[model samples]
Target: MLGIAAAVLFFIAFLINAADITTNDVFSSVNVMLIGLGLLALHVAGIGHGRRTGRR
Candidate 1:
């Protein structure tokens, strides 16, 4: 699922940030984290919309 993938990405990012594994800050930046959370929100919204419309 997208939410699971996003959570994995977030964990990876956290590890990368904590371990100083990446020289590029962009890879472990808050922007990337926010993007993952945005994906989760989008997924939830899609489910809500689907249920409301009764499309399945």
Candidate 2:
């Protein structure tokens, strides 16, 4: 869920920045993408842990 949220945030941010007609802030998009990827990594780690412990 958190990963999904992050991805959504990144997508929205990308759309907003892309649609703007002013100076492009590369940091914003990069930050959002990083955050999304971080969340995804966390989720994957959690899943791996759960599987290793045999927890459903």
Candidate 3:
């Protein structure tokens, strides 16, 4: 799910920032954090959620 993906992104961003890695512009921790925020927002807005079946 997107929520899971967002969590992974947040973790990656945390690692990047904690590790002090700043070599690439695209993979920058801040950018990844922002992306994670976007995903979180989407998750909050009920996007990318799996549809549930009513009964078996």
Best by TM-score: 3
| Backbone clashes, each candidate | 0, 0, 0
Error at 32, model 1, angstroms: 2.3
List the candidate numbers ranked by TM-score, top first: 3, 1, 2
TM-score for candidate 1: 0.61
Clashing pairs in 2: none
Quote each prediction's TM-score: 0.61, 0.54, 0.84
For candidate 1, write residues 1-56 as lDDT tens digits: 66776798788768777876755656665756887898788777674243354465
Q: Which ranges of candidate 2 are over 4 A from the true structure?
A: 20-27, 47-56
When summed lDDT is taken over every stretch of 10 residues in candidate 3, the lowest stretch is 47-56
Which tens-of-lDDT digit does each residue in 1-56 have in candidate 2? 66577679678668757876343566566666777788778877674243355568
Q: RMSD, each candidate, Å?
A: 3.7, 4.5, 2.5
The 0-to-1 C-alpha lDDT of every candidate, in the order given, reads: 0.70, 0.67, 0.90
Output the lDDT of residue 16, model 2: 59
lDDT of 3 by residue, 2-40 (tens): 899999999999999898977589989989989999999
Cα lDDT for residue 21, candidate 1: 77
